[model samples]
Target chain A: MSTSEGTTSSVKVGGLTLEVHRRGAGKPLLLLAGEEQLELDAPFVAELARTHEVIIPSAPGFGHSERPDWITSPDDIAYMYLDLIDVLELRDVVVVGFALGGWIAAELATKTDRSISKLVLVDSYGVKLGSPTDRDILDIWTSRPEKVLAAKWADPAMGKRDFSKMNDDELTIIARNIESFARFCWEPYMHNPKLKQRLHRIKAPTLLIWGEKDGVISTSYGEGFAKLIPGARFAVVPGAAHYPQIEAPEAFLSTLRGFIG
Target chain B: MDAWHFTEMPYPNLPPIDSLSTMRVSLPNKLFDPKIGADLYNRYLDEYMIADDLGLNLLCNEHHQTATCIDVAAPLTAAILARQTSKGRICILGNPIANRGDPLRIAEEMAMIDCISHGRLDVGFVRGVPYEIFAANTNPTTTVERLWEGIDLVVKAWAPCDEPFNFEGRFTQRRAINLWPRPYQTPHPGIWITGSSDLENIKRAAGRGFVFATFLQPHEKVKWMFEGYRSAYRDTGLPGGGGTAYMPLVYTAETEEEAEKGAKELTWYLNAKAEPQYRNPPGYVPVDFNVNALKGTFTGRTDAMRAKTMEFLKEEGVMVYGTPDSVAKQIKRLYDLVGGFDHLLMMQQAGWLDHARTVKSMSLFAKEVYPQIRDLPRTKPLESRAAAE
Candidate 1:
């Protein structure tokens, strides 16, 4: 399917209806979004769909998805998405996740065997590489938006938003997204303390994608995350920070496609 | 009505207002001078003792990582007051149980306070303000749930169960749920949940037969909230409003002008201390309610109301400040407007109000204002209206 061919739909899994965006008609590739707004129609998603059927489901508590009260942690989301995969009857799927989504994907890989053929964690969070006192991820919640943007993007200009022009609906969507993000990631900061040990349980061939200029979580931390997973290849997309897929789409796609192919 | 003396025990000597946008959450600890804090704690305790001696119920509150309120732990303050004050009830309004990693510890601590106070403890549980979510590193989305769960666990722990039982809660879990030094009050000390415009919270308090105490909201808003509580209580088949309380900023002087002049100190508290960003972080208030629907809501109206003058505040019944007679009349009017309250949590010392002035105001209110309004008829619940007909 082409970029314009992508359609938004909903699927009921485990009594909760999840909004899923699907495109293309080849091998299944589940795209998990980060803490920010899930843009399934982004150029990167469309580009990926050209080769494979891209399935993007808004995580529970995000966008138009249903957030059951018990869905408060990434582990819970991992199970939910795992159930989504089973319900859809998708086999040999490639799981691609970004930021918090990446963290969820990592958790999913640990839980699934033979179901997910490959895993890609782009600037993911779910490991403790440093001492308890050391911060692996810059605290986006407490810091100023400009500071958060600076840490999140190689070119801070790309992260700029003219919030004044946003209508109440748009703003409410943004607020809801943030509240959902906080629900999942607030306590224990961004990383699960035990995920480092759990990384070894993942059987899928994994790729650790880090932005060269990623200041939010240092490349060193990415290296540490890669080291935890058995035989996981580490790659960096240059001229990008936390979101290389957005900041440097060509570089990110080249890295992603090279691994998944 | 029972009059309770309350203070945040604010660290009066603050750095330049420009240096910090807010006193809570992200405020640097280096700005906190332990030497000054030591002196302030002693002085604040002295004030509480004086209030106790004057036959006022002593109320203490807890906040984390904020110079705005230096009283970091309510149980500690309650324990201190329990030992010091003889007659006054030690009302800790309250322990922010949602932020506490272990809610059972609160049960243990409050139980200890009750034991120390010799049956004079009133446990008030609060969800705490928004910045506390940041300070305590708690999930804001789960605040209300955690608060209720914590309260349940605390109450259970305090109950006279001969055998240790298991408590499996979403926010808390313990295999052996038992508290040492059970409270002096049978079952437990009276549980009070602080109320705002949150209808669910008001209903929860009413259902649990806890005192629904509202603080600092405007008179009209308080009236609506009390009515909501009473209605909820009636839904639970209770008579009257169960127990209702209102906390208001109060100051009294020899004359009206002196009172107004002194009350101006609260403007610092209302405007400068609480920055909007810190006070109302995302997910602090539920997003289900449309933003437009909350335009004139109680908590939403605070910032605009904060900028108003003493006269405006007095007129709104957000505060009462004047001579003893005038203050008494204001209290009476507020009581009538809100139906009736079983208790009044009066904030006599706020902002940079000096200790001497606070003592003077407290003395005057106790001697003059207290007598005039203490016997005023309590407001009947909306159920009373149905019964009257």
Candidate 2:
């Protein structure tokens, strides 16, 4: 059991609640994110939130937040979160999403209100993977994460695990991540079958941050995002993967910090 | 012309801070931000990689559909941490065994991460949250059974013995299977369990001498859970004795106000973000409903008496808060209130708190509270091993 510095309950939205824990003060900079269970409260946003109120909401069905039954696609998560944007009545919100959430931000970017200050997508998907999508990403959850991420990491060191020893909760986290990953990366495989064509609809000034070594979506895909989104600028993070945020957070954030700010 | 317009904003550029606390990522609640998300994840990867420099344990987990939890939706999430922090543990308390067509597949993946991280791997298991059942189209009744059966198959697979391992159950069917290279650790790597009937899981873990952990609730509140497990040990139904683990989301800072400021958003944000998934038929507890119940959630079988009990518990330090020193005091008090805990896994960088705030909390605790408790049994340092080749 932990004491004072431990545990915070979920923040309520509608009848449901999403786990949000924040520190630092400033303009309400709403953050939409993707991946990783926040086990600790060591967020990298306080620097940014210090001058801005950072509002980071876990996508519905993640963390302490409820997974509404209506959400099934990146678009669904994006549109649903738009509710939060409205509810909080945040203005000039700097909407930033990574990976899956980046995909959602892109979807909503096309439809969100003028309150959006800027849109930054980090290694985002939800668009076509250039030519036709090649490798089937649907099998990722049940298959090897290395294989699932084989395309994302240039240095693929896929290791194996023996799940037999894990307790139910740990196993559940693994299972849920895989299922959710697949749910978002389904059909067109990370890239939306139509999201590429829809890029023209987005109005927010977009910044695309891609990891140089990202193997999942090729560097070519980043090119696609840059080319497709009106006035979208692209930057490559060195020594990173599909998850540049995890692999090269500084470069990723610097590139984004400059563009968003 | 939509109303959304882009404007130049001063996004906080707060630099990382120094500290020694458990290495874990703050899973923020924000689903949308001014900046794109891929950027944020990319940042997490880089920052988490620096955890090795901070001498902290790097961590992540799995949550599908829900926005707050994201790590390895699959076991491969370890690959990121494995490369970032060579010596720190790369844990995956995941792979809802019940939802899978074959749980052993996760075993294979975890084996891979374990190998990649060398011996520095801690594995925890969760039976998948209730809603995951609906999301995966799997039967909840069968998921739990599959979880146990799947566990049996995986552990047997990990054992050094080459003996044929057979597991045939309602959810999974596995025959003799062998995985090469196994895990880096002998007889597999470190194993942990989270959230189950406190008595049943803790006693079983104790007998195996494995790590036991739980989430939510303050330390004092967790005392009830530990007590249930201790009583299980007292029952002496098992041979060896008792074992329990506690993993709490803590925010420790220099001053009480700082810690509260560092951690307050989490309490408020959790309520804010969890609103979407609360509706599950009438009887289901609304997500926020628990806050009121938390004040009165315990011992409420009888309306009036339960209300009175909640009022009493709330006053009796049922939950705790404050500075590193204050936190130390609260933890010590709870330690005395309940049978002391073996280890404390702090997920301080969680919820929507900015990474800097979370790190500040760690810095404060490392400077103040941690030095005081460095000698705790759970805080011992294993000789730092070189990164696996």
Candidate 3:
């Protein structure tokens, strides 16, 4: 079960087997990776593991996880995570999600009353907050890699990696992750139409973290998402794009620690 | 072999290819001029009518958000053609059922077209090209399964069974699956499936006794696909060569030099209109298929073909264009190369091939080429042929 950086284990959630990476010691913090490339051993996740018991599970059809044929949408994954929580008998769980995972976290929070103690959404995607002509979320699926990277990162240079150096296995995993993400988020387009109305059903204390320079989804979207959830706090991590934790790890962790503490 | 005239119904008047990376999926709508679109639609319809007059089957295809193809709705065009043409079989090659939210709607539309055409309707189903999955916002992972389920639902809906049936598919579900007006043709219209080197699709097409079409691939790849289809049909205990069809980009004129001059538009279509990234978004084709492509085992198409010269394409038999006699000879070579085919869907119009030239090519192909190759021996059941031998 032990990997190079962390110990990985498989947990049966309903009919599917999900791979979870466990590290750190204190209170259980369920870390949900984003739609793009489910990297369990990312530096940000590693940094968070130093303080809390970080349980990062690769969503179905992502990385080494087993995706059941019926698991098509984000709601399915949300329910699966809820089942994962029940199966693990985990209590007072602080659920943190990034991008697509953030949308899933919001869904998971609405479904449960006590299992999740707190919710942290990092540059989340779920709310539609603009005119019909306005593009709320960047169409990353069809865009060029450099354009997507430019939108996703505070500095595109940070995200640029020589893909040619990667072997076939690495490329295959990347492809699978992208495919799985598309499977979950392509239709209804990274947001649920009913999610805005259902935000009132969430029982946990919520924190909306926005990367100030996020080009994928604007800060206004993050603010709107916060406004919908009752008793939710909105915080901005400056000098970062869609993935603040990746671009500005120190600022992101400090903000997270302040909210979780 | 039966001849069918096909076009992507391209909006040829557009900005340079250097200005845009692709013609599909992400192509800006600002580039589309409604006046031009209005002219093109009617002009394309006129071309279809001309093909019908010349005694050729009419073929139309659908693509979403693309200048490469203005036929956004195949059934709509088929419905129009049904009302317009009398004798020619209107073939929609075809509606991308996987992208559609409801398969029953397709069943209803096709049935309506059949009723309008007075039973001369050929239903051609396709998994669609890669970019279409993105354009329609459908999941590629489940496209093949969804396509099968959709076809099954459509077929069941069109069946003559009086009792209402229910369909609970993995991708779609419905209660009381019954279609009104049924279809003009009993047992529904003839089903055809277009594929390019996807063996699973070929098998599905052959197993269901649906016509198998290989479009826009090299001749060697088409030959391999035809062999696969024949083998699959034999395995299913079906007779004949799986009702195989091939659609190649074609242009013909009075002289070889004139034909070659006209064929430049096709070169533009091949090089610029067929952008690789737009044609193949991630997860559109299966990972295994791509891997096989990389290993040189799968010979359908590669990105490198985009850079191919017109002469190279002609040499490769990806295109057939010349004087009437020369074109006829080349088609015969193609027919022999692929063993035999039931139909030949010739794309006489592509890129910016003007209406006049398109008409000329269509007229020439109908008059000269069709007569020569129409009676070529079609592929028969491999098992039976082996027994006779």
Candidate 4:
């Protein structure tokens, strides 16, 4: 429904096969896959795949890549791709970022409108949930017992993940990333104070998505993002959590599809 | 603009021309890529004014829920077309209101567009599709009765009455209130009747001087649609005689190869498309009822309609497709077949056709074919037609 200028794409971007599925014929939409490990089931990313040439990079440390300790903040992860896009020579690219990846997209989008075209940030928690009373303890992903997990997720089934079974070293790395993420963002928590003012500088169109039922970040944060960015839209998806990319995938992706100019 | 046919009903005499717009709405599922629907409406005042400027006629039809045909259920889309295409002849063959609670809305919308378009309006009323009737939870059994009642109410609303529109039909209740913003045309833009009806409907249309048209099907099925009007015209002795109209799905191209290429898959698409409609009489979704029997009835003797159209490279091609020349030859047959062609509005947007495709068809037709038929002498103003006749 949204056309990325040239009306027709002369050369189709992206390869025919990727572990994840992508569909339709138009601009290349880059997906960070997840805040967690990206294994192709990032629903919103998959939904975007329906009409776009979706690019999902399995963030090095999380899925197949060896877990590294020094790379704490998301800015470290978004750093390489400024040149990768040049190597691939992709143009008019739209980035759909969620959770941790949302943090990277936010950080990356503020710096470059060069290779990047548009940015879509979902129910993300790059900041410390931004509200004290609205404190989402789930942002750090510590080993909270069932009752506290249920309280945080609101969905009772989400109360049960085998966090206790993880090795201490793996747990340590996870905790470090959390601490580094909060450091880059906790002052504003979910947003960069400089980024909010700088949003007007980014030439590309920006679209933000949040869950109406988001147990992680208040929908007000989504509104905050919309107001901060020039020509930005924040749509709240129903029955979702901090992870709208997973919960209400269709609605989340559709809002993304409609927003990317 | 004055020479442009203001109403699209069954007209017989038209010069040979290739490529014309024909209106056909694909069911909406294949119509979209998602569970949620897509909106096909573009501009209102702009489209009509553009068509008026470019010499193209405007059209829209009825539909209910199905991902394919959004909200023809309310006729808002058609009204939008009316407002948008104000410069062109506004055609709304709608409001399957026989199944509706009250048809006053139909009268109101028609009158509004008529006035807005300055009487550049053609009003088409129909006996609701039987499946659509059942889908609306109305009585398909009394389709004709409901249709007759609808016409009576709309006419009374338009023509005015010494007494109020005081009448009680099986599905209505109306005692008074003539509509406002009365249409600009004195007698109201040409009245049209569309659907599969016997002589009675045709005779009535002839007596009232209403224009007659049908959808999808070919001539044989409703040849009586023509004969009945002619019969009534001869019997009642209207000076110029009655005329007929058809709004089949039409498409044309730069050359026969292009047309053949385009229409080759179109008929296959039509048959494939017609199945679901025929199979589902009134399913969980309204348009999904896919009423095949009635769908067939709307078309011609299916096989004959198919083959007969092919022979008439003269106007009988199975479908409207070909380079400018082949199309002109085929359209000529249709002009002659119905005896006169006062109007021909196309239905181009089909399932899976993007806006780019729609623009291409309109562009080609506007460039090549429309020129051939720009001087439609059979389509003179009423006073001129009367003098010629």
Candidate 5:
């Protein structure tokens, strides 16, 4: 992944001071991150920045962002982002969310599409398509690391992290990410119970991008999710698992561009 | 010092350990034969009664979704012991209030137990184990906070109040809070807190004058926690002395061979397995603990502990067994090492250790080991001792 030059600074939203990375120029694109915070060096991030001014803010309790104790749910995160959208005063903005970020983006769109012109959810997690007893999401917290990795990426090696090779700061950030993800997703197990019912409230042109080989939450789940949203278009990038943007950036970008254009 | 006899009442008749990925969380309940469970429960209760007859205190604990501990409800077991055992304080160490739906329910149940035992009940509260987050459908990140809040609620509920008081906590809330039966012991029965790690929580427990307990931990680790407790207790100027307890596998017999055989059966408790996912739930422990684990410097439970040899366990004071004379010597050595604990919570029976063997071990421990350590002082804090010196 080629490193893209992006200025980093903290944006004060309500009580939260979030770390934001801004790159490129053109249309404003607010990128919501997933379990792990995405850096500017990510290939898909660079691709998005090429045609659009990408505004990526690390959600509260994630990366170096300041998280208030009261902000314990994904909806709390969505509300904070809503304030940021108004704070930045970015109108007709295109919002793209990945995984947990996708869930947040969908949540944001449901509440209001005031500034959001279009919404893109890449392997999003925010609706229950199965029965009460049916497990909608693979439990990453309790599963073995190897098992989770195998289910997370098309090639398991891509998702493998060697903590031994990382520095204290790096390791601490990883811990923070895991802790924050658990804080929000643990009780509901990564979906808002009311989100499925509220999908029609979104006014933004929506796209659901899925990885064909995504084992974390399968493409079939993505398809089921798309049917719930009003006129939400679903597309799959071939030969990619949960993280299509990282695994097959070209195909992912093509699918994303083809929709937003 | 007081000796408390205890057991996990583990059912160890399963297939070979190698065949199963885990012994907890996702283990099928169909594998558990209720016939054997009934026998184990009745036999375990009989052993506790035997301990009572032998003049030893009793301790029982609860764990969910695991074959290692069949006692899923500590209060129920404690309640039974309260009625059956005429002597010996029945200590349920303890209720997993953090995972429980209502802390008030625990307060009510414990109060009833205390009434049944007529003030001989020692109530213990615990932040449920890591794997319990899955079983209880609880968020791990919030449990420690929830535990403290739950304790506060339970404590407040037990206090004498003319009218019902409202409890509004972060994790739990109620319109009216008043406990029925209030507790036979004035205010409440003795409160005990147990966790092997979390030095901060240990200090807090001491500050609140709650008896702190650690089970099956290395003596060095226990010593660290005890030191923390002592310091906190001194700072608070608490009157009850540094109330602390240490539990280790304890088995004694006429011959070394018999004792060794009994000790081997106890090791089955240590061999209890859970998959990697259930071992450390995110936010269940301090971030530093996880960071240290990643850095390979974590001092918590390790794989080596499961496969611990007899000599290794004895050397570390994780287990104390053999003839009465030898067991007494080992206990004395451990006593000096960890300053001094008021209670010696002894796991005298576990795994497939039969009723006859359990009774024999309890009898030997009470007759031989308890008498030797009974007069030993619950050592004063180091500062107080130094001042006296």
Candidate 6:
């Protein structure tokens, strides 16, 4: 259970062995990950863990998590997290999610606000904000590698990985994460068709954050997403792209602190 | 030794390769001049007609949003060949059933084509290539499962069911499943399934008594696959002999000089480039395959294949091209190496090999090479052969 950052543990939830990364000790703050796994020792995570009981779990089928055959969509993951909350006995938890994780967080909130006290979605993906013909998000699967990299971070180099040098375990995790991402997002192209209509159902206090330079999904799209959730405030982190928490950690945390505190 | 003539029907005239990042998926369609494409389609169909006249079976394949194959839909071409050609058995290798919307529709279309050809139809179902995951807008993670389910549904639909049965599967649902026009062939025309590296699918295809095919891999790998299929076929104890097929670039000429030139031109099919990211879409291939790819034990086509010389290709048994007698010898060598394969899917035309050269190659292959190797004995059981050895 002990790790370099804090501790790693597995919690049996909804027939899946959920891999949870825990740091700090205070009020529960459930952190959901996005395209890439969170850097457990990142300054932003370290800072947040100082003020909150930071708990991060890899979405089912991502990282070391066991994905049962029945867990096929983000909605299923959301339901599993709901089970995680009851099993861990966490209450008044502040739920924060990034990118794909943000989509799951929003889905979880819409279903029930019983365990959630507040919600923060950072550069999230889960809603259709455009006309049927319009593309609201960049398709990383089909887009040129350079285009996808450039759109993913303010500095494209931040998104680049020397996969050839990566070890087998590292490569396996990356492959599994991508496969899981595709499982949830490929058909709907990164958004749940019904999530747009259900955003109103989220009863918790909400904040939507966008990186000002995020090319994957524009700030206007973020603003439109915020408008869907009643009382949700939209904040923009300057000098960042799709992954503001990685590219502009301090700015992202400050905005998150202002709203959550 | 039934030979099937095939081409990707490529529109090779394009701007320099350096100007484009990829040849597929996101390639701009505006660059495709419809006038030239019109001429190319007619020429390609004309090549198929020539193959038909020469007593070669015709095979058509489909790819989407790529200049490499302008034949966007194989059924359209298969339907055309079914009507236009008299004797040649028509095969579409085949409908991307997993990517397609309705399995019933595919069943209907294949059945219609079978009726038109009067049972000279070999229906092929494919999971499509990794790059096609983008073009088809289908989920890659569940494609293999979807493909198998789709095949099962199609087979059941083609079965002699008097009552309309309901089909309820994970990917597809139907209230009533009664095929209007049953296939012309009894118990349906021959079912063919193709896979490159998936041995499980090869075994499954064999177990079901479907003709299994692997295209353009190194012969050693094909030999391994053939061994796997033979073993699995034995395990299943399927009735009648199982059918196995192989596709290799094939061109034959009257002289060595022309044969070498045609062989080089035909490799244009191998050189069609897609960006590395597009080439390995997540979930399109199994995680083990991707993990192995990252470790550099790549099972898919390697970059070496693109840079391979005609000599190297011939040596690898990926391509069989030479004078008529030489071509026969190369195929016989391949036959021995892979134990044996019943159907030879010949990619006789590709790249800048002009229509004249394609026709010439087909004619030469049919007239000379075909007769020389047409009756190679049916492959004896590998175990029996090993015991004999």
Which one is best on lDDT? 6
Evaluated at residue B346, the lDDT of candidate 6 is: 95
Q: What is the lDDT of residue B172 in candidate 5?
A: 88
Residue-level lDDT tens digits of model 6 in A16-110? 79999999999999999886775454578888888899999988998889877678789889999999999999999999999999999999999
What's the true lDDT of residue B59 in model 2?
53
Report lDDT per candidate: 0.83, 0.56, 0.83, 0.53, 0.87, 0.87
Model 6 chain B worst lDDT run, 10 consecutive residues: B380-389
Alpha-carbon shift of residue B196 in model 1 (angstroms) = 1.5
The chain A TM-scores for the candidates, taken one by one, are 0.95, 0.80, 0.95, 0.69, 0.96, 0.96
CAPRI level of candidate 4: incorrect
TM-score of 2: 0.47
In Å, residue B55's CA in model 6 sits off its true spot by: 1.4
Please, what are the lDDT tens digits per residue for candidate 5 over residues B1-389?
A: 99999998787878888898888898888889999889888988888888899999999999889988889999999999999989899998888888996999999999999999999999898898888889898888888888899998888899999999887778887987777879999868899998777888988998888999998778888888888888878877784434989988999999999899999998887878888888888877877777887787874474658767888999898999999999999999999988888999998887788888889889988898889999989856558634322
TM-score of chain A of 5: 0.96
Over 4 Å off in model 1, which ranges? A1-5, A160-173, B239-241, B272-277, B289-302, B384-389
Q: Give, for candidate 2 chain B, the lowest lDDT window spanning 10 residues.
A: B1-10
Assess the local accuracy of residue B12 in candidate 5 as a C-alpha lDDT between 0 and 100: 80
Off by over 4 Å in 4: A1-261, B1-39, B43-50, B71-74, B161-165, B219-224, B239-242, B272-318, B374-389
Candidate achieving the largest TM-score: 5
**lDDT tens digits by residue: candidate 4, B1-389:** 12221112111111211221112222323433332332334322233345566767766555543323444533465466666564566666656766665778877877787776667677777765533533455433345667787887777677755655566665578777667756677756677777554567777777777776665555454454665566666566563323566654455666666555455433432422222222222211122111222233223233334444443522432356666666556566666565555556455444443445445555676777777765654432223224323
- Tens-place lDDT digits, model 3, residues B182-269: 9999878999998875787887688788899877677888888887778778778763224989877799899999999888787655
**After aligning candidate 6 to the native by TM-score, how far in Å is the CA of A106 from where it should be?**
0.7
- TM per candidate comes to 0.93, 0.47, 0.92, 0.47, 0.97, 0.96
Specify the CAPRI tier of model 5: high
DockQ, per model, reads: 0.38, 0.01, 0.33, 0.01, 0.81, 0.67
Q: How many residue-pair clashes does candidate 2 contain?
A: 165
